[model samples]
Target: MAAVSLSVSTVKPLGDRIFIKVSEAEAKTAGGILLPDNAQEKPQVGEVTAVGPGKRSDDGTRQELDVKVGDKVLYSKYAGTEVKLAGEEYILLSEKDILAVVA
Candidate 1:
């Protein structure tokens, strides 16, 4: 198989799928104690990078997603597929997995 190249600009989610760039995990706690990498929890917050047009309704109408690109969002824990692109962490998840859009 031929090698394929992938980038943020080259990715386009389809049918309510969303692409997000994961935020860095907190390195220190509120008490000012440093935590090890293994002790850090997976971050559920991220910035929207790419989004699908919309989901298809039963009547064949497209239902637009509430979130858009550049929106900081909180998603369900254990949701989405983790992706590594260009040494950066990302997540590909369905719209349903997103809990809320951070203000």
Candidate 2:
């Protein structure tokens, strides 16, 4: 798929998908030790910035998604394809890839 080029104010997810503003990957340890770039873990948590109209069901009706914009969620470590928009980082993934919503 072509990469989306959108400003956060205008972007909306297209299908049972969501746009996430990825949290910055941690750069230091709890002990205050600085970590190199390559040592930082790929962040799996992010805040939902936009959500799609839910996926179509077998009967062709759309089911509502469990999450909404602003929900903090944890997804599979490698779930979404990363994209940069208006100088900010984001990931696009299906709702199924989100493992949990951080309450």
Candidate 3:
């Protein structure tokens, strides 16, 4: 799907999902040589730009998400749907897919 240019107000993740702004892969290694496009690893960490209204519990009450907007998170690689909006990349994934929140 074509990504919509992101703004916290423009996109709201549904259910237990979240919107994450993926960090760019490093263009160069520690040695300073630029890595080719094929050599860069997929980034698993990102800043949460937006979040859903929270998931429903078995009792039908809303359960809060562990991560909030502006929280840095580590997610499973190849877990979420990828979208590019106005040349910027973002991911939409369920909260369960998030591995951890970075301190």
Candidate 4:
């Protein structure tokens, strides 16, 4: 089998799915205490990298998504599939999984 190569530019989401670049987990506490790698929680925030066209409507039309590329957003903690490309962590999830735009 031939090996496949994946890159951010080569990926496209179908339906209402979205691709996001995960933010780095905090390495230290607010009190200036250093935390271990395993002690940090998975970040629920990220920047939208790619987005699907839209979800299909009952009349075969496409419903536009509220979020757009480069928007910083917060999502459900357990939602989305984790992926790594070029050593960068990312998540592919449905638009519903996104809780809010971070402003």
TM per prediction: 0.98, 0.89, 0.87, 0.98
As a TM-score, model 2 comes out at 0.89
* Span of 10 residues, lowest total lDDT, candidate 2: 3-12
Stretches of model 4 off by over 4 angstroms after superposition? none
In terms of TM-score, the best-performing candidate is: 4
Query: Of the candidates numbered 2 and 4, which has the greater lDDT value?
Result: 4
Residue by residue across 1-103, what tens digits does model 1's lDDT show? 9999999999999999999999999999999999999999999999999999999999999999999999999999999999999999999999999999999
Give the TM-score (vs. native) of candidate 4. 0.98
Q: Candidate 3: where is the Cα deviation over 4 Å?
A: 1-8
Clashing pairs in 3: none
Writing each residue's lDDT as its tens digit, candidate 2 over 73-100 gives 9999888889888787899999999999
What RMSD value applies to candidate 4? 0.5
lDDT string for model 3 (14-81, tens) is 88999999999989999999999999999999999989999998999999998888999999998989
Better of 2 and 3 by TM-score: 2
Candidate no. 3 TM-score = 0.87
lDDT of 2 at 56: 95
How many residue pairs clash in model 3? 0
Candidate 1 achieves a global lDDT of 0.98
